[model samples]
Target: MTTTPMPVLEELSAAEALRLMAGVPVGRVVFTEGALPAIRPVHFVLDDGGIVFRIVGAQRLADGLHNTVVAFQTDEYQADRGDGWTVTATGHATRITDQDEIARLARQLPLPWSDRGHMFRIEPELVTGRRLTR
Candidate 1:
């Protein structure tokens, strides 16, 4: 009888986790809506040790997330090799209202959707990551 090898799980340092997060463009933002948990997939950029993303016509979501604790997660998996890594950042999210900052971020991170939207930044207080290796 053949036996399959067990996968090993490794914890990543904050710096390495952040580095991995920077390599990905899309992640999930977890927040609360109507006192219930909700998650949205968004295109994001790692900037100055923070996560920046935009939302369009989502006033309720923006209001709910602004100045509130949230979680941002991104992961990459290689099914063929059965190895992958996932990173999660938890922090308080704040809306960006400055015109110049908004313009600069728009230039730096281009989103796939329309330009009209609100921008938010989440300065992570806790960053955790794990890698699964075969």
Candidate 2:
């Protein structure tokens, strides 16, 4: 019997990681809630090397994220070919309170969610990624 070869894992550069991140629309945001770790899936867009997303007002996740260090991750997999990549960005997230800026992002990103949600931008301080290939 012939054996299948193992997939190769490769590290991606910061620019490449961001490029890959921009290709996906949904990602997970990790933060703290009630002194414990909490993660939520969010629809996001990559802009100027930062991750931008939305959350409804007065949410525990939103309240905890402002000016806070958090991790955002996104990945894609192809099971038939055994190839995929995952990118994680760690940074401080800031709520977009500027009406003009929020308006611009609203015009640009057009997130498929409630319009009343607040906008947040995560300026990635550390970005890392790995790719698996057959």
List the global CA lDDT of all models: 0.88, 0.86
> Whose lDDT is greatest here?
1
Off by over 4 Å in 2: none
What is every candidate's alpha-carbon RMSD to the true fold? 1.5, 1.7
* Per-residue alpha-carbon lDDT of candidate 2 for residues 12-124, written as tens digits (9 for 90 to 100): 99999999998887899898877999888878878787788887647766778899999999999998887999999999999998988877777666545526687899999
Query: What TM-score goes with each of the models?
Result: 0.93, 0.91
C-alpha lDDT (0 to 100) for residue 53 of candidate 1? 89
Q: How many residue pairs clash in each candidate?
A: 0, 0
